[model samples]
Target: MTTKTGDQESPLASQVDPQTSVSRVPPPETPAAVQTRFRVIAAFWAVIIFLGFPIWWKTTSIYRASLPLEEMVHWADGKTCRPVFPLEIHLSTPSLPYIEAQHLLRTTQHTLDDLNEFAAHHLRLKLANDTTGDHTGQDSSEHVNYAARETPDTALTVRLLPQEGLASPRSELHAATTQLDVFYPPSQIPVSSSSNSPLSTFIAAELQQLYGEEKATIAHILSGDTARLASTSPQLAEDISRRLRRSMKYAETYHLSFSLFTPGAEPSSWDIEAAVNEYVSPLLQALSPISNFTVDTQVQLYANFAPTAPKPEYDESEAVWTLKKEGLSAFVNAAEWPLNPSIGTGPTINFILYVPDPSQSPLVVKENSASSWIVPQWGGVFLLNPPLSNDEQGSRSNPAHLSLGSLGPAFMTFSHQLLTLLGTPSTPASLPLRLQTSIRIRAATLLLSASSTMGSLARLTESLPSIPIPATVATSVSTTLSHLTATCSHLREGRFGAALASARVAETEAERSFFEKSMVGQVYFPDEHKVAVYLPLLGPIGVPLVVGLLRELKRIAAKRKAKAS
Candidate 1:
């Protein structure tokens, strides 16, 4: 009803206020506020760049010590060291004049040099100097002992003697020592003007034949080319290959554990101590020069076979129980047997003497009726078939305790097995020479093994960039290389004992460096996992900071454009 101007104005004002509320704009930001926002963002980015990033990098970076990678690789590739064997032979001609001895030595050396095909192995003959000068009735051993103390490089001593009515020259190698006795006619002695003689030729040929197997074996190991060993027969090569395949790796010390495992309760105890002393002690003593050994014995009864193993079947034709040849691998009940290795740093060779129950007495391999077998680098096993006897109740059973006489055959087999496991060659009949061969073999094996480990470590570091290499590993590598050098030098100089010692050090250091526990931790924590862990925390904070920075940069750019216009 009141059509006044105030009422009309009020309604329009209300309509205008609604429009203004719908389309309103805030006030422009002051330069101080913009500068403050920019400062805040710049400060945040500065903290992240200077403090947080450095802390993260410092905490996450891996330590990698500088290594002689090239030198290691060269050594592994056989470029740094070429192994050589310089065997020294002493000529002890107590029955001949010095001039004649020197002439014979010259002729023999000439012939030896001509016969030797492998340059890596050469023998040098030196005349023995008789310092005592009293050769009336001194034992040969005494002279040998004195010479040994004088010069340890004497590999073999040749004692030349003139015998009565000898048609030709003949050599007899001493089994109890490292001397070769040669008997020849008095007229066969070489003159100084003579370039060669029949006696010299015979001695040279004998020496060559004696070291033929060793030379071929070394050639095979160094080159792996059987063609280089043309002097060796195919059968001999195959035998050497098989022996190498079957032999255990080199170690400074070895633990020999003799255990008597039986399926039944009887035959629990054995004369292991006496048997070992009789059969194994001499071998261990002989091998002490190459490696140290610790002997231990134990007895386990009622050691049943594994459930998954094949059961022995009774053959009526043979009237005995037999195990399948293929099933011998599972015959040892590892779970039930207490054949644990002895506490030591080196490997343990376990020899188990298993006795079957009365019902399954005289167990033999079905294929060939063999009673003993080798586990191939593990150990040996012997099946003991004791003579059955009647108990008080007239029940036939195995003896309760094995006597020393009853254990003789088994211990002898174990001794042979031990020698085989140690990679002893079957020739020359001289135990000392065989042991010397073992020393060289062990040195070579350790050198190659350590070299292989070094190569593997180098490749591992290259392939896995994230793995941390500790300083200890570096030190170990250095030690290994140094010892490897010394080993090579010792081998070149024919000091096999020193070579073995240096190689032991090399092998130990190489193993320690390659098996470093700290190097394996990074393999489980990868870069993707790191990204996943950090993304959530960084994403929320990073987005706002980045957006503020971009906006500030755009505003400054626009202000500069305006000023330029």
Candidate 2:
């Protein structure tokens, strides 16, 4: 037979001839080769699934702190709680009989229901004891807030009295207290059967006027409904909004940033501390009920005009130096002005009294010849053209010293701006009453703002999944929720100062939860890369061990077969 190449299977196969039993080499190692291949695959798989994968996982995984993501998210959603303001009005009848007083209250309530536009804010009246002439009044707390709501924390006290000369009816508002004095002619008192009466109409009008600003403020805070504030004149709406914008958000404390700005460096030091105490101390003291204030005065000289600002022009028509009203918005020169806010807990309300050089004296509003203008919620600008003084020789410098007296007008403007920025309404005259309203306004603002922030945080968490939730986020959420509860409780209790404090905490906590660090980590690595790295070391070391084991197994099997035969 012709010998075949190694490729030919006949050459490798064992053949027995008739003349002799030919022992041919067993088809060399086909079974061993297959066994070696399986063992090599098993070795790689064993290393990969058992050791390599675990180590890689351990190395690459990030530490994810336990967080109450679900709870935090839920609180942020409106599903958790709906905030409501329930105001109670106390009604006292010093002049009428108990039955007549009760009837009048009922009629007034009915009329009020007819006039109310917003349903969320409703006034409820509680009858006082007529037997004891003393209607319960709130006891003074260590905190001497004029409008402190104790004695049931009624929003307003209504005193019904009989007036002889009044043709129909009239009401007088006490500037000091939230008390409205209603004078109705004795004859207009509602009869037991009458559901509606002229007395009720008078009561409705009186109540409406008293709460008109508050209603507009609430509406603006709750719904941003400036248009609905038409009941308050448009000028009032603009004034209120301007003040609100200028005013710092409700805080436990406000940083009073009093800055004295001058074009040149001459009078760097002012009797500032004294001036502030003399002029501003009373206003601050009056505002103490709503929040605390920290005062600091800074004097910044060499404050320059912006390049784009219009230079002072001598107006022949008015015989005064004029600055265009349109140009006033840029007068602050924020770029160069050192009116930085004070560093602290509450917002920095900057009070800038810019002293134009003596050369630019008698400065007036170009359009109106006005001496002063308010910078919305920012501050006020008052041109202090001090009367030109004569030296011993009767000559004056190009500019004059900014007297402590000149700062009076500027400070006054600043005070007005400060009030507007503080969200103080314009109608109420008494300082204490305004502060009480401010307390309520701040409380309402804080509540609504925190709620909206919660909603935003909930949405943020939902939209992004890769970010890890830290335990701190959960803690912050719990803090926010608890504070929110406290704030609401304080609001209902008529502890607005306390409510604002709680709401501040809530706002801070909510912000922390929303901006939690380490929440986001990138995650994308290829599996093929891991396999290529691990396979090289495993392949060479695996072949021999697998082959030896397979050979031993084969020898054992042959010996067992021979013995059995």
lDDT of 2 by residue, 1-565 (tens): 5667767656424464744554555666677787776676667668867998899889865554555556555555545544445567778897778888888888888888788876655667667663343434646453345444443355778888888877888888887777788888888888999998998888887777766777778777767766864466887677667667766656667888887777876446666766687678888888876667888877788887899898889988777888888888888888877776447555777777666676676778888787777665455666656565555867553234455675676676767777777778876654555676677777777776776776776566656544566778767877887888888777666556677778878888887787665663332334556578868976886686567657667876986999999
Poorest stretch of ten by lDDT in candidate 1: 1-10
Q: How close is every model to the real structure, measured as TM-score? A: 0.88, 0.75
lDDT of each: 0.87, 0.71
Q: Count the backbone clashes (under 3 Å) in each candidate.
A: 0, 7
Off by over 4 Å in 2: 1-59, 62-80, 128-152, 191-193, 226-252, 265-269, 397-406, 488-498, 520-565
Which lDDT value does model 2 have at 90? 77
Q: 25-137, model 1: which lDDT tens digit per residue?
A: 87999989888888999999999999999999999999998788888888889998988888888889988887788888999999999988899888888888634356557
Clashes of 1: 0
